[model samples]
Target: MKITLLTVGKTEDAYLKDGIEKYVKRLKHYTKLELIDMPELKNTKALTQEQQKSKEAELIMKKVQPLDFLVLLDEKGAELTSTQFAAYIDKRQIGSTSHIIFVVGGPYGFDASVYQRANDKLSLSRMTFSHQMVRLFFVEQLYRAYTILKGEPYHHS
Candidate 1:
């Protein structure tokens, strides 16, 4: 299955960008992965949290195709171990799924519309991380998941 990681805003830190690139490069061997950075909204001083999320929702919806399996990287979502995640990825590859789009939303999190559209929700940890950091962590975990799936030594139980 082809995987797409669609996130809000560009990864600014040089180190973080490099880290994401490293795993993304390794991931090419396992599956096709696409990285999309949605532009951050400007002039947010006047908008309420809900309003910001609502506006962001509009942008998010535009990128989503009717057939894409959407997954949100949310704080309240199910948390899985690396091995379990591997199984999760493997399950999709075994199924008729063609595209899996994982979204990392902006600071206030996803709006109701985005939630309603999502097929699944996954949490990297119980603790919250920045949107930028989540991108890196998610990609690395994705790489780890693929490695685990391949029975590679990169991940150890």
Candidate 2:
């Protein structure tokens, strides 16, 4: 199964961009992983938080295909251990999910439509992190999960 990570806006910080790139390269050894940066909405200074999310949601939905399983990275979603996350990926593979698309929403979070379209939601932590930072964190965790699945020393029990 292919794994795709969808995020809004670019990673402006050079350090964060470098870190995300490192993990993306490592993840290529395990699965077909793709990271897509959805363009930020223009003229957002005038739009409300809800309006911004709605506009972002439109771009997010466009990237999804009919067979893709949508998973939103949300604060209120399920929290799992590293091993559990690996098991989760195993389950998806067993179920023959074509593409597992994990989305990190914009600054104000996801719109109602985007939430409704999601098949599942996962939380990295209860505390909030910047959307750009989350991109790095998620990619690293995804790599760690694969290592755990392979019984490698990259992850410890």
TM-score of 1: 0.98
Give Cα distance to truth, residue 100, candidate 1, Å.
0.3
**Shift of residue 108 alpha carbon in model 2, Å:** 1.0
lDDT of 1 by residue, 49-108 (tens): 999999999999999999999999998889999999999999988987899999999999
Over 4 Å off, model 1 = none
Which has the greatest TM-score? 1
Output candidate 1 Cα RMSD.
0.7
Worst 10 residues of 2 by lDDT: 148-157
The local distance difference test score of model 2 is 0.94
